[model samples]
Target: MPSPPYPVNADGCHPDKGWTQRQAAAWLVQEESPTGEVGFVRSTAGFNGPLCEPLTVQVQFWRLTYRSAAGAQARGSTGSAPDYSFTMAAMKHVQLRVDGRRDVVVTPPKGYYSSHPSPCVGGLVAFYTGGPLTEKELPSRIVSGDSLLTFDSADFHTNRVIDSKLSSPSDPAVCDADGKPTRPTSAPSFPAGALLPTPSYPPIRLNPTHT
Candidate 1:
């Protein structure tokens, strides 16, 4: 499995926070892939269980342009909102990839929302606010494990955003582990919005086909 783009710190910083251009280049060459696809896979158990009731799946992709000491481009899911924003800062632009389509720059407010910079790092971030399942939507029970829940780029933006907010920023922050930002105790709240009709659940089975 591919690791998320963020670091593992609470605030998303690390020891090697500021890498020299040569270091960044070397790291990029060894650590990051230039192009890739990411998405969530519903677990067979979740689909069979009650937790799947309100959940929906979505996949997102962004064109990453890295700047600083070294510059490069890559394609992959932003993981979650904060992760999207964190990933965005290193890149010049982003294109939303959903349902097998490419080069879809999501229109903000309708498709997503750019949010306040995290207190730890002043990086710009964004999340999906629209959809049948807004951030407010909650599951009846909590599921766990690689088998219980899979989150990549393709799940509802709300889920992506919430997951990012809940995730350790250190997991994605460009800085090294010692220099990553401190994690936020309280997650940022979602803006007010109407709840769109929930997407219907796809066939519940082990390894259901994805677009």
Candidate 2:
């Protein structure tokens, strides 16, 4: 929402993408009712320390109209249709603020009518700012902590938990590279070069269910 020093000349008139040098100078100088009129100034300096050129604002009015159905008689008349309409008054004004200070009043020229309500019922006041000001103008960031209490604890516990009682020793389980059992493997094997134990069988018994 940043704005240039002056209103942009959409027709490629201003070279700096801002106010032209002449426009800036005119804004700096304050003038009375140059045409010997009153109510608003013709031109003035803007809040951004630049000139604001004179501008004309237009207002309009409207009314609602109604028509009866074709060939329909009027509500209280014989064989005649009736039409109705109503008028509403609305107004709009275009003005400039100088350096965000002072409201100069100007009188509209002949043909300007205030009694007839304008169709556009609102006022427009434009001011210049470097850009839209933000209430909270800061960037955001996030910080995180390590999951492990210590590097050694993470390294040792991770391997031990993986090797416990669920994997083969040769398959990266139960021991480190030197084949020492720092953790228990799912199945125990005879030590390297050691004889296998004699095989023994256990008795099995079934328990009755009491559902």
Candidate 3:
């Protein structure tokens, strides 16, 4: 699998505590694609598990897939970008993917809010306010590597903002449901969102069809 666009710490925390708000603002500025190219960024989240139950978690996944007003003029396509936002109120987990190769996880600080910057000209933003989740709480598909998609490094660059509130670096150990530390035998698997609903545009396959 390809590495995430953002910097991931040993604890599987993207951005960790070193990333700052200023960095996030700067990253929000989209970079122009050379060949009128396009790419995508993704964010996933899960809920209704052991941590927070009874009530489902509400989430908003945003995507920008077209050229901005100014961007369209420069491209000479006379086309403006469209905003793609998906809201999931009740689900075990949700995975949002764009039309590119880069997969990103939007992780904020322990007590602060954070967003992920998209690698493509028009990117995706992930935002959610809920209790921190554990690996077991993540969707079964992601844990089993059924929905985890990998793409080429050159295809996308997932730029994410880091939280500056952290005083010390994060611990490398992956935490369990009870808040205990557990070392992984291999590379740690970050949290992933579940499948997306069918949209008007072409849908990216989250799970591979079995033969």
Candidate 4:
């Protein structure tokens, strides 16, 4: 985890409380799906170098809650009922790497307990190149692997492999255009395009004659 040069602000946090930005960033972990796409999770995420550098990040789903801990603890802890006053929103806040670090930040409403996220669910969140720093999108919710990415820069101490390199899933299977769960929540998009593969089909055995 890299030190985010800024504060990790939340409802119950104080100016004096919280870990060093590096420590907090470390608390954010990633669980790579069997396919090799990276899912980043930390209270606060940061990016270095220039904003002009092209980069695309996909946020599958997230929760924002004000709970009593240095970071979000998702297991063995049950959160209270949803309260709108204490907003636990999934936001992708970006600014120029050197110029306007403090220009953008969202302050959640006061009077909340800790980081227990909302029960509500939303679609994939993303920040694309050339878009406004404060603006983001939920282009598609389905997860796929149409490309392969490798981290070859010397800035990295060790080589890294990103198996399924996807810019953004062009078709959404779980979410809608606005990041909301679509109606008939269990149904798949019609026409059955390659981008939207059906999951319920029976498995096929290849090379059955080999034996």
Expressed as tens digits, the lDDT of each residue in 23-141 for candidate 2 is 43344333333322223233223323222233222211111111112222233323222221111111112233333234454443232222332221111111222221121211111
List the candidate 2 regions with Cα displacement exceeding 4 Å: 1-4, 7-52, 66-211
Residue 10 accuracy (lDDT) in model 4:
45
C-alpha RMSD by candidate, in order: 22.3, 41.1, 22.4, 19.2
lDDT by residue (27-99, candidate 3, tens digit) is: 2212222222122233222110111111112222222211111111212243322211111111122333221
lDDT per model vs. reference = 0.25, 0.24, 0.23, 0.24
- TM-score (C-alpha) between model 2 and the true structure: 0.16
lDDT, candidate 3, at 181:
32
TM-score of each: 0.19, 0.16, 0.17, 0.19
| Model 1 stretches with alpha carbons more than 4 Å out | 1-35, 45-54, 69-211
- In terms of lDDT, the poorest run of 10 residues in model 3 is 47-56
Q: Relative to the unseen true structure, what is the C-alpha lDDT of residue 78 in candidate 1, on a scale of 0 to 100? A: 32
Error of 4 at 93 (Å): 4.2
The Cα error of candidate 2 at residue 159, in Å, is 75
- Comparing 1 with 3 on lDDT, the higher-scoring candidate is 1
Number of clashes found in candidate 1:
36
- Highest-TM-score candidate: 1
